[model samples]
Target chain A: MNQTIIQEVRETTPLIHHLTNQVVMNFSANGLLSFGAAPVMAKAEEETAEMAANANGLLLNIGTLTSQELPAMINAGKTANERGIPVVLDPVGVAATPFRTNAVKRILSDVQPTIIKGNAGELAHLVEIPWETKGVESVGDGNADEIALKVAETYQSAAIVTGKTDVICIGSEVVHNHTGHPILGKITGAGCLLGSILTACLTTNKSIEQQALTAVQFYGLAAEYAAERPDVNGPGTFLSHFIDALAYDPAKLERE
Target chain B: MNQTIIQEVRETTPLIHHLTNQVVMNFSANGLLSFGAAPVMAKAEEETAEMAANANGLLLNIGTLTSQELPAMINAGKTANERGIPVVLDPVGVAATPFRTNAVKRILSDVQPTIIKGNAGELAHLVEIPWETKGVESVGDGNADEIALKVAETYQSAAIVTGKTDVICIGSEVVHNHTGHPILGKITGAGCLLGSILTACLTTNKSIEQQALTAVQFYGLAAEYAAERPDVNGPGTFLSHFIDALAYDPAKLERE
Candidate 1:
């Protein structure tokens, strides 16, 4: 475990500016708060640019993209890039519709994201790789490693591919995270919550890859703890415990 | 408790179309699902009318509303009205800003909501009643009864004023619910989740007030059940247990 990154995030409580999908705003905000970071969800075009400029990290997600938010997302991303702050982009359900794909493309063309995160199918679409996809669920039985590598090389940014075994790639280097529970799949916005916390993690002076790795491992560990609770009988129970685990003291997260 | 409404919602599994705010979409969807209602969140202007027209109920929430969605919300509400399905309006945080207030007013003018739900502050603003408010929290010490009654009279729709105690007013009759937990106040979308379930409950053959009472009673009971769980410690745990309790068989929920 990269305790330094976790410690840094907790101590600093970085402010994360989110122009994320509407579906996960509350969860993302709560998750970030639980993880000891400040979250500000502002997508209005009138204030996004200014908000992004001041935030320690910026996250842009397209889970519920509309034509109207593209300009605001781009403006925020551009401002984050200019400030040299980390910008994490989660191109959720990019392959589900042309409007989503086109919107992601527009954001990509204008902003140099520091880290790009998505499931394998969504990442495959980003790098133009052939991977079976159905409404952002499956990464399928393709070369997930190749897809992650391609996404890393194509986007010129670190890529995190979340699935049964999460894969993260930055340039030629790659890391795999296997500490997770399947309950995360049953709940919505597990990945979105991860993206939000990742934004905060990357704000530390640590390497983006190191920060991403620590964040992923810590998140999965939290899920594991949450799911293992005796009262956590289903997705609903696990969801609540997961939030509590995020706020749990990392030093006390030892497994039995 | 009206067990019939719960049975009807579980049996029919009504399809609820939600044009709600981004902050609570996931929670509302999951909560509604847990309550035996299917939630479909669609806000695109192009498809909202079609979606709402086909749904058993429609929910319009303006928590984090944007300028682009007012037309879509109005269109969906109008469609629901044309089909004679219930439209549940949650004017969340309307007093915070003019954009939110104006958007709710616009939807109110174009669409006849069958049940208008809000905190006393929001509902008071709707009825042109004065109440102290900051953002979306307080109902203060105002005449919440008058606020609910005036809103019911003014909109010609049932009004629900939610605060420490929830007041439901339909025409001249008003009912107060006393079955919730203080922990509900700590969560972000407790009210929004109630509105979604209320939409589903209103779809039954029973009178609107009966269904509303049942929904409110069942929701508050679920919160109480969840909050009393031995393992539940805070809002995070309460949230998850609340969802589980929403799905719990009513027969099994009786306290010791």
Candidate 2:
């Protein structure tokens, strides 16, 4: 992926509207701001559609979904679709409960996200592939690339499955990113922040496949940079350094 | 304030159940964990009461209030009250919208929080004191100590108003803490995370006023420590070091 995309994000400062989970909003917003993207979180059903219409991109995450947020998510997704702004969906813990699975199914059918991002287990669940999930963490072992490809084909959107090896698929073309660290999983909102980053990346005039791959690669590399810092002894410290890494020079990051 | 309270919090590892806003949940949980407290976030009405019953303390923050979460907050607060577990209320953005103001009033009447935490604007709004607020931020300048004292007297509970100087009041006694930094206002959830920490501190066997004051001082000292770090050039890096400082030794913090 061209590193210029990061520069583009910084220059543009795209406004991305998020109708995401309660657990990850602050991290997601801070991460977006660090990546040089403006994030606006509006969940009130009365204002979500307008927020989405005004944004350059929209992200829908169901990590800690409530009955009230479900409609707002749907409304924002539909408005983003109508406005021609890219919508990225993170199907967090879809296999954890019937309520979540049904919600994702409804979102997929009604909103039609431009890019669908999740872990192997979440992506597999979306495609009706049997997978074991414990709460929001993906535990099942499966061919992540195949699952991502299948989901992309089914939804007719770009698919990104992140893990030790991040997989991105648009139609039949696939790319793998091996830049992130194991510590990424230790902190909550790491995946959710990635979804926000991808939403920001989607605002740029790039192909869906390239945009998703770039986002995964950028986030993974930042995690690697943060994990190597002397100050980052644990997940708590890693969070601070990771945000700093997001705002680091893309050219310098690419050189490293 | 007795510094031993910090050691008690570390030894107890109190489980704090949070019914907080969507924006600050992840940070609040991480902050609580960094301070040697177990954090549990449960919002579903069906399970919140049981969760509250099992927790050592409960925190209710109405930062991103939705119609669905209002009832759950009430239920959890009532359950905590019934179980005699301390409930701390962060009346976030109550002055910004009537929806939030009404929800806070309902919770105040029904749940009866053990300690009420907010900025001067939020506390003032609780008593129908006119104050200008921009979104969740407190913009109006007023006597924070007076407002805190009035709120505490009216509710017959401890009241904490946090800003450049943190103020805690219970009955006729009032204590002012000049430990926090200006950089705190730049980050989202800085106040909300304080509510979580205060909740954890409440689980210790200390007076309500002392518990609130110690939490504020400890957090402010952590922020000071984080700001002094070599890598902490801005809010992004400051956040990382702050988490590490939360887990730092109380003796070391005192020496500095």
Candidate 3:
């Protein structure tokens, strides 16, 4: 797969502003830093517009959405839209509660995201596809490809549906990437970090579809390499190695 | 240091209710889980009282304190106090912004935290001690031992003052633990995890001072062991190995 995008991300070092969930903030920041991008998390409603205005990209994740931050997220997305920078929205666990479902709908109505990323169940909720979910964990699949296309077509934005076989779609075009590890399933912020790195990828001059595809491919590959290490016994060890792999050359990713 | 506390934690599997900052939620949850304690993060004011009432312990960390969650934190701490369960208050970066400082002050006014934990600078800020700090990272030393004692006396809660030499104090009694690695300084949430695991320690029948001391000692030892691993090169690798060390037997921590 094209690695130049990765090189471009490193050279550009885009600053992605995050108004994300409380669960994965630090991990996403470190992961973005490891992937050669800068991350700034500014969630206070007072400064969302200002921070988003200065950022190269904006990521809105509602993993642990609070009522207080919803307006801030809308403002941040609007600022990013006005600036013509990428706005990646990850509607984390939208099916878990009515609060989340309504909040995401409110966001979609107010802002135009460049890309919307989530697991099968989460993205499926956006398109009214029936899917099973427990809390924030999405294991049920609703035909990921169709969900991606529907989400993309519905929102007039690119869609990244992550699962066993990841699917990305934009404007009737679809890309399938099979490059991740199950170890990612064991960790907490794996998907959140993907949204973060994907935001970084979008900051590059590459086409939106290819940028999202590369971000997914690189994230999966990093997970594969990290999980394959001999010293990586389980999720605990795999998480750290995953961060390291984000910074490591794919060739040097596995020394085990 | 006694290792039986580790066994107690594993056997009991106490549920720790956290109303912590956004940045370290996932890491703290993973770290606490690795340490054999269950973590429940419920910050919404609507559920904080209920979650804390059911929890074995409650941890209130203002690392990224926002105005929206201050009331939730206060309610959670009050609930934990009423239930006679241990409440750990990690006033992270209290000196950074007036928002954090005022939020902590407000929480302290309404709720009686069982134990107050912070870096030297953060604790100092509570007691009006002058200590230089940049943002949330506290490198200035304002006599952590004294700050711990003063904070304990002022708040009627045990205080854990973390720095190069970790100090834990309660009711004029203090414990100094020197067992951690500098690598811990490289990673985020090291202190937050200590507050988490320490909250687990507090749930035991042991005295609060002893429980806090043991938590600091065990955490430092885990960092030392994780940092000493041959495969651990930088902060990225050290963090994963550190999580493993949290779960590993103290004896099996550093085989490499």
Candidate 4:
């Protein structure tokens, strides 16, 4: 992945419309802002489509699925589709409840997102693969790269299955990112924030595979930087330092 | 305010059900947890009442009001009232739009919250006092103590008006807390997080005025401690440090 994607995101400051869950909206917005992208959250059915039409990209997350928000998500997704703006879907906790699984199916059938992002359990649920999920957290392990590739192939969208090893798949190409820390999982919204980063990166003209790879790599690098800080004794302090790391120059971090 | 209120909150670990905006859910939940309160967010109209009934307290915030969430908020509020669990209301962005203002009125008339929490601009809007509000942030100056007193008397509830000086009022009695930092305003949900903290505090057997006062003072002190950290250079760092400070013992901080 080209490091220039990060620079491009900073320069463009793409306006991203987020129809996300209540659990991670503030952190996702703040994370996007730290990465120099503008974030606008509009969940009202009355305004979501218009907001999506005006935005450079759209992110749809279903962590806190509500019956009322389903239509707004579909509407915003369709609008982003119409505008040809990239849409990233974070199927959060899809295995947690039947409501979430149905909602993800509804969105997949209607919106046709440009990228589908989820953890291994969520991705398995998306593809009907057996995996143990304790609420939103994936407890059982699986081949992330294979799952990402299968989901991308089945849905015809770029897929990112995140875990200890982050897997990004677009068509036949697959990549892995292993720069994140365990503390990243201790805080909420780490994966949700990654979806926002992907939305910003997708706004650029990079290939879908490159866009997915760049977002995953950049986010993991930021988490690593934050975890290494002396003041970041735990997840609480790491949350703030992670934001600071996002705003820091990516060039300063050690490269693979 | 008795400093022992903090010790009580830590002992109770009250479960708080939040029907809040998407903008501040994660931060509020994390803040509550750091203060030794268990936080649960349920916005679906189907489950809100059940969740509220099970919780020790409930919080209703209107920062990102949607037509769908209105019914859920009302249901949860009524259930919490019926259960005799304290419900805290944060009339966020009440002056920014009529939709929000009318929603606040509806909740106020229906919920009968035990505590009404907001900034000066929001509190003023509740009682029809003219004040300038730039979105959710208060821009106009007003007597927070006077506004808080009026709101509390009119609604028959404790009122907390937070600003450079935090005001807590129950009936005719009003108190001021001078502990928070300016950077609290720089973050998205500083006021909203305080509402959650108040919810946890109200779960104790303390008087309404003392509950409000203790919550305001404790939150402000945490913000001040967070701001004093050497690694905390700006709002991003302050956010993480604030959470850390919330988890820190107040006796450890330098006494004024």
Quantify all predictions' global Cα lDDT against the true fold: 0.85, 0.85, 0.84, 0.84
RMSD (Cα, Å) for all candidates, in order, is 6.2, 6.3, 6.3, 6.4
lDDT score, candidate 1, position B165: 80
lDDT of 3 by residue, B1-256 (tens): 5567778888887888888877788988888878877776756665568667777998898877767788888888888888898888888888988888888889899889888988998999999989999888887855888899999999998888888898888889888998888888888888898899999998887767667777888888889888887888999888878887788665665343
* TM-score list, all predictions: 0.68, 0.66, 0.66, 0.66
Docking class for model 1 is incorrect
lDDT of 2 by residue, B92-142 (tens): 867755666677889988988888989999999988777876545677898
- Better structure of 2 and 4 per TM-score: 2
The collision pairs in model 3 are none
Question: Can you write out model 1's per-residue Cα lDDT over A1-256, one digit (the tens) per residue?
Answer: 6788878889999999998877778889999999999999888999999999989999998776667778999999999999998999998867755667778889999999988899988999998887775434553777778988988898899999998888999898989999888767657688889999899899998887789998898898899899898878667887777999998765666552
**Candidate 4 structure quality by residue, lDDT tens digits, A102-200:** 888999999989999989999988888899865456779867888888899999998888989888888878888887887666576888899999999
Q: Classify candidate 4 by CAPRI docking class.
A: incorrect
By DockQ: ranked, best first: 3, 4, 2, 1
- Identify the candidate with maximal TM-score: 1
- Residue A66 error, candidate 4, Å: 6.9
In the range B76-155, model 4's lDDT, one tens digit per residue, is 89988898999999888888888997888888888889988888999998888888989678889978878998899889
Clash statistics: count for each candidate: 0, 1, 0, 0
Q: Residue-wise lDDT of candidate 3 within A82-200, one digit each (tens)?
A: 88989999998677656678888999998999999999999999999889864466757468889999999999999988988899998899889998997576567788899999999
